[model samples]
Target: MKQMYIPVNTSLSFLLISLFATIMPAQAQSAASAKASAATSTSTSTPTSTAKPSLTVTATQVGSGQMATKLVANGSVAAWQEATIGSQSSGLRITELMVNVGDVVKRGQVLASFDSEAVRADLAQAKAALAEAEATALDSIANADRARGLQASGAISKQQIGQYLTAEQTAKARVAAAKASLDVQQLRLKYTQVVAPDAGVISARMATVGAVLGNGAELFRMIRQGRLEWRAEVTSADLSKLTAGMTATVMAPNGEQTQGKVRMVAPTVDVTNRAGLVYVDLILPKDKTAAAFKPGMFARGEFLLGSSQAITIPQQAVVVRDGFSYVFKLNPDQRVTQVKIQTGRRMQVNGSEQIEVLSGINAGTQIAASGVGFLNDGDLVKLVAPSAAVGAAPAAPAAKK
Candidate 1:
């Protein structure tokens, strides 16, 4: 057997070459892979570096302005005073109904009439009795005069003259009683006609023809003076803000607005609700049909509490998410940061609807005027000029091309 001897250096060199060959290809492939990954990363990150705007909006600045402060309250429309018309005479049958519900009536106007035949007959009988009593009184006067003249003579005994004088006095008393009865009967006859107590609109009628009513039976109900008042339920804290003369604007359910003056504030607050009533006298419109407010109708009112400096923003700028109100404030970087704001009174400023920012934002802070609802917190936004934000008139369709 022949033994083959090789050079150790040569064999080591060859093994090193083989290992280098394998490692070089792997390293080259690894480098190429790394370069491809880097390129992919760069391409993916380039779009994020130049972030696109989420929305295009016009910027508005919070402004300080004098806005009328108001205290809003809900209440019911009621009559200033309600009068009940009732029968003054008992056992009187209603013969005629002259008025019905919703009829405007004046004081002393006949609303209904009762059967007066029985009353007139009683009056006639009383008149006859009075006449009889008057005639008897005249006779008594003559007898008393005769008795006085005879008292000085013996033709009439002293005891007999005294009896004649006593008889005369009794006859005079009977005549006076008969006159009183006559007056009562006359009054009864007058009560046959039910009259209005005050000038007002009839709200309810309960009397029916041929129905007999007892004394003090209600026949009709009226709103005194046709005056409607709003009784606003205000919290105790706001009660003091209202005086007897402050102006209140009340809105009816039909969207009709009426001006009113505070008549009075309730003296005591309701213990259960911790609220007080403010009575406001409404000034009805000239046209009765235009005054849509009616008794018992629910209404809302605002008491102008005078003007106060407020920081306000356009109403459209505020976005409500979940249950909180937010406004997107433009940062120096042209990005929007969602700011939670406490809102107060909403009012019209310069023909635009604005809402008072009670807290959270300061005056002169730039915010997204519109399209805020579509934006999120920390979103990039492109702000256009106010004039540019509004679309142009479409260039008149380019003159029909």
Candidate 2:
């Protein structure tokens, strides 16, 4: 009905309005579809993730045992009691020697013999002089006896008797003097046999065959009683700890080990070296290692301080981080726990470096043997065979090209 008054412009306006109404339904449908698609995508889509990194490691178990705490030093093995056997008689030439170096001799055993020809000659001359004096004294004594017998009668004068008594006294004195000289020569002959002062091992021979030695000239040096000792030189501090009963081990140049006991601790320190000596007595029965070790051998010694139980591990298990020692211990969950430990003595057992753990770790614990330089606490690590790792961890699996 309104079209009776509608103009051409009004008709165009109506057409434009109808066209806009038709386009609105299509736009609403498109928006509803887009909203539904966005909801479905938000509810069912998968999330993106990143894989964590891990490390492979090699490890060793904690070692548990007793390690002897010891104080180490160097010293010399020597005779415990050295005796210098010397010539007691002067101007005597050695004729025969019955012993040499390294010979075991007994007390009062003959060691050498001196030439007794001079001694025998002196003794013979004294005996001849004594015989002459005895002959003169015999004639004088007979005259004295006749004089005494005549004194009871008138056989001789009193003055003659006195002269006979004086002659007899003089002749007896001469005989006494000759006899004394002969006895002195006989005593000299007895000293020709040189004998050992005590039972010992001969270490040195200064007297050669036919050696004319003076009185008190040394002929041999021996270890009295065949006893040996180790004179270990130690700092003043270490010397104080050694007592009379402490045990020690001495290793000779030939790698022979001998056992000894602390015999005495030196009271004074040496001025030059500022060190003191500890004398250790060696027990060398003929059946023991006594024959193997000799005097003047340079040996290293160890004084065992009383020992207690300790826990130890390979040196590689210990990691130095920020001036602290740490070890990675394997846990029940197949993970590792970083443990801070106190390190004690570092020793070698069969060419391997084994360290003592004082605290923060226990026996039977597993630790990373090596290659722990970059590991953090609570980090997951793969355990690899020790041999597989050249020096550290085994090479990782090659990635796909």
Candidate 3:
């Protein structure tokens, strides 16, 4: 009955409202279903976040131990005592040279020979003069005896007897002078040979064949007794720690190692450098010629000052980064915290190299013994028992049956 009076515009409006209501409900349901599907897919595809251990490692505790203490020094290898060999005779030519540089020689060993022809001729002349003087002395003695007999018989004047006695005295003086000249000539002859003053290894040679040398001219230089010493320069404060008879180890530039004993400590320190010299005599090896140590070689040495208590850890536990040393300390939660440390002397303990921890972590602190280089600060690590870690080495595949 109302439809009989309803306008066309009103009917269209009703129709649009009904259609909007139906479509809105359908779209809302579709959106809800899409949201539910998305939630289910996300719940199934997402992963749960769980932290994993970065590395599996072993732990060690810092312990107090005795480490050998040493004072290090830098210096040179030198001859214990150097002897300069020279020519004692003058105006002579070197006829022969028996030894060269690096030659081992003994005391009184003839190193060079000089021309002795002139000396021999002079010696012969001296001998002839001595013979002539002896003959003249005998004649003078006979005359003196005859004059004494004549004086007793009063057959000769007093002045004449005095003259005979004076003549006898003069002749005796000439004979003595001639004998002294012969002895002088013999000494000159002996000097013709240049001999070693002491047993040593020759270090330098200046004598050449046919080269005339003057008195006191150097011919060869040698290290007396073939001995070598390491002269280490140490700070004055540490010099007192070194004493004679202390053991020292010297390392040559060529990585050759030799043991030495402290010979002496310099009484005075250098004013400019405030350092003193510690002379250690090296115990040369059996084959001296083949020895790598030589004079004037720069070397480094360490003086053993005995053992002292120190906090130490295995060398592998320490890590060096950016020129600074560090160690990873383990926390109660099995996490590693990087700790910078000061390291000192390295020593062998129980056949393992241990490094002295001067400061940083204290004794009883646990640290990552190995695999530290691969770890970072505040990293979680898994720990295995000592026996388990040893057995963890990759086992070989079983042999074929």
Candidate 4:
């Protein structure tokens, strides 16, 4: 059935209010852990305005080098020995036009001057038929010396002294055909003057003061001496690393550079751009007053294709990420390790931009330059200026010899 019982001072006042609600939540969690350990020892003895973030970066020290390797292409600059200058005599006209297209001629100078008034009236009708064939060859040697002195005094009659010595050999063959027609009318009047057969600079000047040209036509092209050349076109499998003399540079189109040599390599190979032609030469720099080195411009060459022994760096000290290639380095306490590299031949000498390091990285290390995309691995940098962090033009160090 059922049973009920109570008492003992109301179960000792509900067991002292459940042990004073579990000892007042463990004495209010031990007085809130002694006021959070006295506010962490009063913030470890105060004093702090906040600092710690530093990191400028830019190191260097790459080591083990030599790098020079080149190949590049694309080119132009021409006229290393042009020299057309024509007019072997034909019509005429162009009367006067002494030289222009940047002048500088020499060899036989006298650039143009035709219209010899009909070759000076055919050189005055060939000096009036060479003075009427020297007065009929001096009256046929004075009638063959008076018909051999009147045919030995027989009063000239050995068939009239062989007809006066065959009429003095037909008047000395018509005075040697009128002195060869007055030396061909004085050589068509000096081919109507239009000289400059070399020593050049005038790259072109199609006769104009009247222009009547014809035979051999042309008129003036020059450059035979104002030298300059640079063809380049390569690729026929690098045209066997070019020959003739090796050494090149080019680049001009305003960015100026020059310095060339390899004077010829072509030997066919353009079957629709399979590429070939080399021809370098360009040298110019004898300070032609800072001569704006010209000639069909377009340059870009390189060639050099030599040199070796390398390790190189800088090129924003690597760092590519997903596609690989990286290079923080910089330890000695400044932190930042990263590394990973492998690159190979990516030149730009005298102006910097190097990069070779073929394989994980070793030589002198020390990396990081130009804000390596905000660095990471172990961080903690601050190298400061070190010459504005290595880049005011830092590419020369990699080889320097």
Best candidate (score: TM-score): 3
Assess each prediction's global lDDT (C-alpha) against the native: 0.89, 0.85, 0.89, 0.77
TM-score for all models, in order of appearance: 0.73, 0.61, 0.78, 0.42
- Check candidate 3 and list the clashing pairs: none
lDDT (10s digit) by residue, model 2, range 1-401:
67766797788999999999999999999999999999999866744322232567787888887777889999998888999998877999999999999999999999999999999999999999999999999999999999999998978889999999999999999999999999989888878888898999998999999789898999999889989899999998777778899999888787778789998999899999999999999876575467678888888989989766779898877789889999988766556788999998766788988889989988887887766666667766677788877655434432333
Clash number by candidate, in order: 0, 0, 0, 0
Better of 3 and 4 by lDDT: 3
Name model 4 segments beyond 4 Å from true.
1-95, 98-111, 127-131, 134-174, 195-221, 225-244, 256-260, 263-280, 283-292, 295-305, 312-314, 318-327, 330-335, 338-353, 356-401
Tens digit per residue, CA lDDT, model 4, 82-180: 768788888777868877888897888787877777777877887787788778778877888888887767975788678767877887787788778
What are the per-residue Cα lDDT tens digits for candidate 3 across 179-233? 9999999999999988899999999998899998889999999999999999999
* Candidate 3 deviant stretches above 4 angstroms: 1-59, 287-290, 330-335, 349-351, 378-401
For candidate 3, report its TM-score. Answer: 0.78
Sorting all predicted structures by lDDT, with the top scorer first, yields 3, 1, 2, 4
